[model samples]
Target: MTIYILLLLIAMQLIGVYFFQNLEDRFYENFRDNLEKQAGILQEVIKDKMTPGTESEKQRKAIDDILNKLPLDKKNTIQIVDQESVVIATTSGENSRIGQKNKSPRVSRVLQGIESPSVEVSHKAGNRYMVYSYPIKNDGDIIGAVYIEAPMQEMYDTIRTVSKILIKITAAAMVGTSLLGIILARTITNPVKEITEQATVMAEGDFNRKVTVKSDDEIGKLASAFNHLAQHLRDALSQNEEEKGRLQSVLANMSDGVIATDRKGKVIVSNRRARKMLGKDIELNEDINQVLPLANPISFPLTEERESFLELNRDEDETLILKLTFTPVLRASREAVGLILVLQDVTEEEKLDRQRKEFVANVSHELRTPLTTIKSYLEALDEGGAMEEPELASRFLRVTRQEAERMTRLIHDLLQLSKLDSEKVRFHKQPLRLEELLEDAADRFSFQCRQKDIAFSLSIRKPLPRVYADRDQIDRVLDNLLSNAVKYTPEGQSVSLSAHRRSDGYVEVVVSDKGIGIPKKDLDRIFERFYRVDKARSRSMGGTGLGLAIAREIVQAHGGTIRMDSRYGEGTTVRFTLPPCEPEVNPA
Candidate 1:
């Protein structure tokens, strides 16, 4: 707008100067032309009158009469001068310049028969004049000259008035142009400025501000389009954020660790589980091969390949077996652009599978030994001589009965273990006095201790806490512990059962025996099914090797914990704790 106003101002100024200058030039040219024509007409009419015979006063009078008849204004002056450059007649202000020698160069030249007109300033009248001289000739002989003077004050006054009007017009034009410039600026510049500001804000990720549209012009339409584009951009950004949030949620809650990499094999996305499984040092843009535990290195142009199980040994106590599944992320063109690697920790599953195999093998081995013995004895009795001797046959049948009983015990233990594993066994729980249960178990194991010639004792702390447990299961647990203690104790060794209330609100029952204790290495596996430190001695003594495992399961089902503390060649102490009964439950 300002530029427009400045351009208009300059144009107006140039045009105004040109028009005024031309008008002044034309005005002066027409004034001079009219003055010269009038002077010529006066010279022609008075030329015969100003010839040699006429008196100077009559000639002047004749010129005045002619000028009066020619409609000349009072501001004009005409003079007739003779051959001597002397003024004869004057019409300026009634004989003001009469009988005066006109010494002007123009008049002298006309008297010499050369006519010329020139401009000069009159010192007497203090005015500028356009002087014209004309030679009065009679029959080609110069007789007198005519001198004319026209004052230019009126043209000067008219030029001054026109100049003032032109200045006023130019000023008025400039003022109006400035006002229009301001209006145009408001109409156009303001909206463009608002749109630019909104665009800047949108660049900085804020799309909530809108431009105000005041008109339905081009600028307003542009602003509307900008607003629409901003809305679409804002929606697109919102959807991207929501998708990112859902992806993060899925990755965080997934059981398997997930890691996503770009085509360059740099990690792009990793979740909490992935970081935990890998390590805290795992970071975005890190090389996937460096952090991931894979049996083989990852390659570009990844394929849908499952790597072999990789072992991650954190410590001696904890080892992890992870299965890595690599899946290539493909675009719609079926081009592999990245990779998604999933890590599944299958350590516990692998351990369970191995245990299942071992359990099956052990069950078969346990059943086969007895079945083989019974088969061998039956075959011998089937021979003719063996069946004919009654004593020998009775001996063989007794051995066969013992072997069958061992098989039955093995099968029963295996079934119980299976029930525990599947959580199919339900406990019928009730409140019971810990001291009475200890005494009952000690009495049941008394005969076994006597047969081994080992002394058994029971110690009960007074006011022992009662426990809530299934009576039959608790009895079996007690029987397993006592039988083991009696069977392992040497003759003349001592075994003790004690019950007490512990500080952590549990009833602690301990069975300690001065027997050949377990080795430190075998202590950890003592509670495992079919695991025996002395396998040969245990099998010979009619042990199924599942007693301790069953005991642990029953104790855990009652919400208790069991542990063993044994020193090689010293003694063994097995202790278990059960939660005390609530105050509301009456003791059984």
Candidate 2:
């Protein structure tokens, strides 16, 4: 509106000024021209009356006659001066002024004949006038002069009136322009204002409010774009939240440790699993070396195709064998921006590999012992010892046979273990009464126990749940347990075989011996093939060291669990469990 007013005011002012100037100029020019024409008429009338012989009074009479006949207003006056520089006649008709000499510079200029028929204008103290001077001539000789003076007050008054009217017109134009400007301003600004307000709401995370479009103009398009942008931002934020949730879930539940780091090797993201694997109080931006020193040697933007492994021996009696993979985050230009480290715990796998190698070595050593002994005895017999001394031949032959039998047993146990490990031995699962198996095993071991003077006992709880197991496999399990008990128990000590129904629908069997118990450290590995606590004693007792291993394998094949618990110098208990059989339903 202000701009409109300014433009209107400026245009109106220029037009008013030009009109006023043109009008004022035309009015002054026309006024002067009319007054000069009147002066010319007076010169003609006065010149015609003037003759070389004509009297001054006659000239004065002629000028006064012309002046009286002239249509002059009150602001206009005329004077006639003779060649003598004297006022001869006046339009005022004053008797004192008719014959007096006019000493005015204009009249003197006319009487001297230096200049003629001149118009001059003057203004002072709000009074304005123009003067016209003409010479009266007879036969081209100046005889007298005529002068007319007219006030410009009426012309100035007309100009002032017109100027007042133009000012009013300009004011009206300004008012109209201001009102139109207001309308235009609202039309353009209203939609913009609404969009700004709604955009502010959207910025505050509210996308409900929509800006109203008033026109199909730029502002309306902006409003439409704003609405779309609001919705897009909302959707993008929602998707971001969903992806964030999924990522968090993966990080929290995954067994592997995930750590994301920046290009500077500063930790950026550390998931819950990573923190738990590292430390619960682990902080972000901690150096990668602090969290995983193995990464320090491998620079970002990995140069190798394969990742490396790290064996972290924790100080808290925990060992972590981690396989580490370093992946570089890249931009569109393939520039390295950061790194992601995936740490997979390989502790169990490494432990199993180590155990397998140790088992192979132990098997070789245990097998070589009996074979080497048998070979020595056979060589002694083949070297004529049997021919030279029959007694020596018998002893050597017996020792060799014993060793051969031990080897046979060891080979059988090895093959059994291999089949169990390969899952090639199928178990025929059926119901086997726990009490019956217990009684049968007790009777079989009773003679051995009596010969050694060791008290043997069987405690099978009545109405025990029938075990779900392979009948032959369970029998071997029971026989192995009782044999171990009898073999390990010293004379005068007691060995008890027991069975009961567990609350969890399983049958628990236990064989306990008051014998030279295994050390606490070796209890966990007592069932391992070729593992022994008293190697020499076991060999002397004709124990192959594979009994417990074979028994465990059979029990496991039958879908049961076996474990051993022992206290050094006190006793050892081997326990196993089998799922109970479903009760038989009788048909009516």
Candidate 3:
């Protein structure tokens, strides 16, 4: 397009210059011809008026009369010279050469009997003059010469005016031509511009868009081609959508969560797994704030140089963990138009991973002690020192038995935990009196409490509500709490077990001890399997550290909850609740 415009401008300039130059030459020629004719006529009048015997005054009067009668056109300057090559008369009221001689070669030649017609001479006035030298002839002899001089300033002036007019016309014509070219260029380039814009939109992945077909010219034909391409692209996109639907179906049925959002951080689609993880049927077009309230806020650092992750806590009241990843969806223009959120439920996976690591470390540690003892005992025996070290051997065997028992207990607890985790353990549910249960559990620990010189007390609110739970699991729960209380309490300190009906119609049992209370930091994690606040003390007291974890699991299985409250160096209280079940009314 630019090339076309440039060529048009160049052609217009050339034509304008040619026309101006031609007009200038023609104007000069016409003016020069008119001046030559006027000079010739003046010379004829002068020659006719002159006679060989004519007196000077009469001749001068005739010359004045003729000159006066001649037209005084603005551009003509007339002068007359006599046969003496001297000034004779001038229409401008002075001798033709008052201060100079008539030095024109044409005048001298005409005086010598050569009848010179009108001729052109360059003058000092910056214009050419046409001089007509006519010989004044008498009876068969040349007498004098009549010279007529007419300056060509009028012709030059006419040519200048015509040249200026022509230049102005040429300039106007060029300007008009340029304007027309601009209009034509717009007519052709506008459609091309529209096509370029449409193509850009398609490149941005908007296949549904098409250009407007406004004409039947080449530009219109290009638009039609672009629209056809858009149609094909739309069909391809439809096919891709079908494939995506199938893929989404597969993802929905899987255990992992799947979530996707648009550029505005609005939830566009989600699978069943995600819905389950969020514990609700999340709808499309919902903002992320409403869909996943517990998830971390989205940070749209599109211009940042780093990627980010969000740890979404779906169930703050339960054990649900969602790991969400944000990835930018870049278009062909390298712009971030949307983001994809991938959610994964890693709760159980993380738990199992922690368990695996702990298991390995625990097994290695558990085996090391026994192996060391066995190695030492066998080494002593191998030195043939059995006779002298029989008593030492007996003590070594006892120590070996204790280590083996510890390993067996650890394995048994691991197996129990596995069963509980897999839901393979059977639970027999029945209604039991809370007071009776607490009494039985306390009785079993009474002797141990006395052995440690610790006071054991039980506080029961009368008419306590009966709880629906597994009897054995509840018994284990009570046993663990009481044992923990006894273990942590100092000798002569008090351990209190209390049962009461909560306002929410649940049976709450609180076992508190004034012992070397757990540290504030360790209170939350005290129920984790193999997590002991005082590891040395727990091991010295023959604890496997799985009792509290098992207790929490069993209580949770019965739809109950357990929590601990403690202040370092003061006391610790372990509280648990079980929902009350309706009592069986006797027949009236």
The candidate that wins on lDDT is 1
lDDT agreement with native, every candidate:
0.83, 0.80, 0.75
Q: List the residue pairs that clash in candidate 3.
A: none
lDDT of 1 by residue, 319-392 (tens): 88887887889888888899888889899899989888988888889999999999999999997578899999
Worst 10 residues of 3 by lDDT: 301-310
Q: Give lDDT tens digits, candidate 3, residues 1-588.
A: 567657866886787678667876786567656655665576667776667577876777787788778775634555566667766566666653443567878778877766545355567667676555666555545545555566666666776787678778767876787777777666667777877888888889887766787778887898899889889988999999999988878877877677667777677878887787777887888876677664356655242222233344555545665666567777888777766666777777877888789967876776676667777767766675774777876876787778778778877887887788888889988878878888888888888999999998988987787778888888988888898889888898989999888877778899999988988779878888788887787988888788888888888888889999988877889999988877435211
lDDT score, candidate 2: 0.80
Alpha-carbon shift of residue 478 in model 3 (angstroms): 1.3
**Model 2: residue 287 alpha-carbon error in angstroms:** 2.6
lDDT of 2 by residue, 317-412 (tens): 578888888888878887778888888888889988988998888788778988899888888889865758989988998888888888888888
| TM-score ranking, high to low | 2, 1, 3
- True-vs-predicted CA distance for residue 570, candidate 1, Å: 2.6
TM-score, every prediction: 0.68, 0.82, 0.47
Q: Which stretches of model 3 miss by more than 4 angstroms?
A: 1-359, 374-400, 568-570, 582-588
